[model samples]
Target chain A: MSAPGGVLVIAQAEGGALSELSREMLALARRLADETGGMVEAVLLGENLGDSAGDLIAFGADRIHIGDGAAYTAYLAEAWMPKLIEVAADAPPAVILIGHDTMGADLAPRLAIRLGTTVATACVEAEFVAGRLHATRSCYGGAARETLSFKTGPCVLTIKSKSQAALDRNNGRKGEIVPLAADAVQTRVRIVERNVSAAAGVRLETAAVVVAGGRGLNGPEGFKVARELADLLGGALGASRVACDLEWCPASIQIGLSGRTVAPELYLALGISGASQHMAGCGGAKTIVAINNDPTAQIFKSSRFGIVGDCQEILPPLIDALRVLRDAKDS
Target chain B: MHIAVCVKQIQDPEMPTALLRVDADTNKMMLTSSVSPVISPFDEQAVEAALRIRDALGEARITVLTLGAEPARQVLKAALSLGADEGVLLSDPAFQDPDSYTTALALSAAIGKLGDVDLVLTGRQAADFDAGVVGCGIAELLDIPAITFARDISVDGGTIRVQRVIENGHEIVEVASPALVTISHEIGAPRKASLRETMRAARKPIAVWSVEDLALEAAQTGALGARRVLEALYIPSRDIECEFQQGASAREMAQNLARRLYQANIL
Candidate 1:
């Protein structure tokens, strides 16, 4: 069979709205499809995720593949990989785009291994040149960027979150949904239970605003200020790896090369020194405000606006001001 | 229980490097003579996880393995200091700069050389490159079940119950023994090295194995045998310019920021 002149965007059901990264992929894929005269195809994997199909179509997907089963209710490599391989074999998309989130992080490499293709992760930008996919990624903790070209087949790339803007949806568009058989393959690993932290609010990946604390917060108690600010802003809370390492914040809230990558409209860095690892994770933020006593702190290099003062003195007043503004708007 | 942990030696990332050179022809990063190497951070987590498991199981034995230059023995020593029963170094000039796939094959061969191993443990990803592919690649090569980004793991009735970190949450997975697990830093905080343990590790013999000893062909590993090639490397230029917001009072700076946010329609 001839190769499918389309891009396959893997979507998750739980992370609804096609996710910012998937939307960004669609935007990039749409450009690729326009150039290649191919269609943009989306693959949605989850249990009972049919509700999300319409959004994918609106975002420029010409065809959608839905693989729904209890096995996919949570991510299981044993289950997800086989289904994805089947879809890829049947469709034979020239390129497969995945998010840089944890699922994409695990699935992309495994899928590339199984499909015998080359895969690139944490891609800041990607384009098709001379029929080959070239992806640019941050290396050495965002201190460097390298453009990599794949000479292999079925090029798979995971775009870093917030690297590309999500395409504006065309409201009335609809696409084809092809359902796959999930029970055909036996899974070696069985997910017996799922424990999601109830305290985790407004997932950092999807949040529009994020308030992050660092080691400058001093201790675990200092995180409350960042948390309160996030809560007031109706956003999520984040921490530098140091804060997490100090046990001041949970690992889930950590943002860095080893933690979550967030692309928020506003990122308030409270006392973060902005190490390369930490900067790489938040480079996507549209606006960064750094609060630190050290004027020479590296965080200022990446921040659009910086405050040279202790977060302890700066945060409470900012939080109060935001609270006033919010209350004024509410009233 | 027999647990095999894979470790790697890498240049300390947090250290300030004055200069680094890449061979124009070979595309290899050359560290300055002043540069010092330490155990890869993720590998430290792997060692800690193995040690914890050994302590919990009581009868378990932990063996640490690595492949690199002679100085790579430092990683094995660190592992030994952390309470590993033995250390094995697969040091050979040819193993340098192997792609993830080739490295996986070589490690799999080394594991095969080690005889009956019940569980293979490795860090989710090495600090260098951060490809996060080796453990999974090894599992693929061995055709064994592998779990990546394991935050918590327990041995229950001969089955490995692992908590795998997903995008927004975690899932509890149960797989039979002889499976491979790649642990994340979330597994647990690493233990501190003590003076006594450091002295003990100095005397702990590290068995060295080469490609010839493992019966692996030189053509099977390293850059020549690798599937992927780094076409180019360059430093990323920072676009945002830093302007020091110096003011007499913290409130004054906040006022300026609030005005800027308002001007930017962000307030």
Candidate 2:
């Protein structure tokens, strides 16, 4: 853990390709490395990662450690932890960057414990301050931001998704690709089944516009108005934690502190009270429009425009008007 | 079977953002009297998950544990009222303002002191800090398997099965005893405590433990044991001026709003 080394990015492959967050991590690592005069390295562990290794280099990785096998396909921390440690041993990293997703949250702290290094999770901003890693993360359910620095080196970090900008692909970039030392390790935990819930349209994270429903909608059926608005806008539909907790919407689309964080161009909040936890997810939107009957609702505080009326009373006409505007623009 | 569920009490996360203020001196949120404290919502769900395990086994011991100030005992009482068998509060002057690492260190020591915990349950992330690392840290310190974001959990014989929520969907994972599983919101709402249980909880004796009780050194319990240092803490300011559209009717208002969005080039 004390060896002089560069930043290490752990790349996660989704659907046989490098995930967006992985690329973002590489970009952030590149920035940190450039500032500190260190090389940028990444570990890509999965089957058929030949192309992704190149993508990782193109995204700013100076070296790619490949663990290409079926055993690396599933995200079993017990299996991958040993491999990550092996990589770190070969080239001890000053900073280890991971995507602050499910896999990262599951692995970072454990890796820190094993490596005897400090770790930070869900960090939005990370920089090298006086040769130490300083990371800023949203806390207090996103009501405040806290900046923390490690007391020592080799800090493990889980970077929040969509916080860092990914560098443009540069096919001309060259990096080293080496095979990791293979080992057979026994894992006590097993993933028996994986069920992929069918997503309807544009993904919530990448959607340009998002229409979200909340408790003000009252029940499951009220989401139809939200769906119609999203459809008209050609965007994605989202929900508050309450909506998802009540089973009115899938938890996958819950936008809140414990759920997905979205930064769409336009966020249309329907009947949402804009609790701090919920705002933690959608606060990054360029523009937020809220429709809640309660004038004192918290959502209005963060919104650019607000309509203080019952969503049920105003939504149908609003949808109709938006549809008409769309049709007019189309014709 | 023995189950330990770790919970935390914090200023209600659902409190209005306007009330949130940072104490520059301490680099922490100013706990205002205007905001009443509540058990972290996800930790409540963790208590619920433990109760379900007890119900499934029909004869299992569930102990609710919390590491905070004395006020944290309130959360333990709430859990006890909801049917947990025992309550343990790790409270001491030396335990104040520990980072995630130290927090986990102290909690793991307490778990070891508990002596025979077969399984551990905790919220996916505390509603306040949202660190989501203590459960795994405890597992790491105890050298046990940890499964996170568990939506559903059940016990069968000596193994524990969990439906872990992932980015796309869920993955059903199984592990043997001596494991830690972090509960998620998909576990559904926790059951309410009955009036009789509430009264009974009022009389229940809570076991309070200190750093010495867990055999943890003061240096390894709080700020001294902290792995990371907080440099700054402050609320991010937002200044979006909201414009309300005026109209003779709801439809007119909707029309005006749409046109305004287009004019602003946001649509």
Candidate 3:
């Protein structure tokens, strides 16, 4: 086998467009490849990758490998892994990057085992030094960060969402497009049902502004105020792990170490003490505004602005004030 | 039916950040008395998942396996108290501080030693290291299929059905027997051990296995076998100075905060 050199990103598509995380991986791959002196390549796998190959090149991919078929749309490690190995046979990549989403959490480790290697999972930072990958990941429920380096090359990594910036599209750049057949592999796993419980308003993972509530809300009714605030701001509603555990909110919207990770431009944390675990999910927000009655809460330390008061008392007036501002801007 | 559930005992993840102390020299958290050890929350849920299956079947044997130090037996005992039929403690000096790869190797070896395990279950990830790889690694080593991030699970004849959590929603997946499933926090809280069961668990004899017992090489079972090298571990220091929104009353403070956000262009 040839020695691994370039970086490979496994691109994912949602609603017929390249997923935000797929683009983020391309951005990171570009930076890493530029620094390490290797080509930036991507593998697009789906039923109909239509124009995604061109998009991949525009996003800094030097080459795009397409695996188009019905089997590629829904990810089952059994079917996708062999296809990936077959695609990489032409030019093996030193590092394979996947977004640390549901598919990644299932695929990376198994793929590493198949390749007789190891994976650095959910990495927030990574760089190539001395021909090896050094990755930094959070552990101890996000209370601490651990930096690790692989002993050998040809490793896999699942990058945390929103951890890196996507480069601006440059249509003028040129790249190669290679198509590969979807090999037949017997897969034991079958997706019997796919449920998309549609929620109103913006999606939490990509929302620019996020409004999160915690146990300090006193009861489930508190979420009514939070939902109204989120809808008024055209944002999304989120909850801490405790609130979800207490059944005050659906677990689908929980934001914490064990839950969803959201990186918004502005994060308003209401009635939350900001445990390290909870902060892990939203620490990437550009601006954090915290409101808790406890002046010394941990959230205050991470917040750019804090208000020490009861959320119940502050939220109503805050909503009114936001309404006034929105009306003024509209006029 | 024979089921094997893997569990781990670690410092309570819910402990306050002030109590979390890291030893720079060792690259490990300082295990102070203030922070008590408990079963990793998700692993406890895994145990619950196994018990739920056993309850539905009316006749099934569940075995709890844990690879850690002697004290790690507490997690096994906790599982036994929750109605696991047996407990196996995989412990050895060589097993100390193993990475995810070595840990998976040792656990899979132990499972092989069990001779007949129709199904395997584990938490999505341990709260401490959060590597989230052992379950899949075990599946690979055993040459079986794995469905991860399972929020719900049920069995029919020789097939296992799992409701897996995806990005926007959930997907129901089905695989044949001898497969593995990693339980997520969405599985709901685990049941508490009763006082009588706890007493019984205290008296239950747990089988202990060493590296040699599992036929694993000393060089391939612990830190010596770890494929990943830890360069550093530390808490990220935060120095953001928070400016408090001030006003004469709650309503006024809300208004001022709104105006401040607008001025800062954050709204």
Which numbered prediction scores highest in DockQ against the true structure? 3
Taking chain B only, the TM-score of every model is 0.92, 0.96, 0.97
Clashing pairs in 3: none
Candidate 3 stretches greater than 4 Å from native:
A1-4, A329-331
Per residue, candidate 3 scores C-alpha lDDT tens digits across B111-169 of: 99998999999999998889899999999999989999999999989999999998668
Worst 10 residues of 3 chain B by lDDT: B196-205
Candidate 1 chain A worst ten-residue window by lDDT:
A12-21
Q: Candidate 2's C-alpha lDDT? A: 0.88
Which ranking of candidates, highest DockQ first?
3, 2, 1
Which lDDT tens digits does candidate 3 get at residues A88-179? 66677888898998888899999888878789999998887665678999987777899999865566899999898888989998999988
Cα displacement (Å) at residue A201, model 2: 0.6
DockQ of model 1 vs. true complex? 0.52
Worst 10 residues of 2 chain A by lDDT: A1-10
CAPRI class of candidate 2: medium
DockQ of each: 0.52, 0.76, 0.78
Task: Quote fnat for model 2.
Answer: 0.78
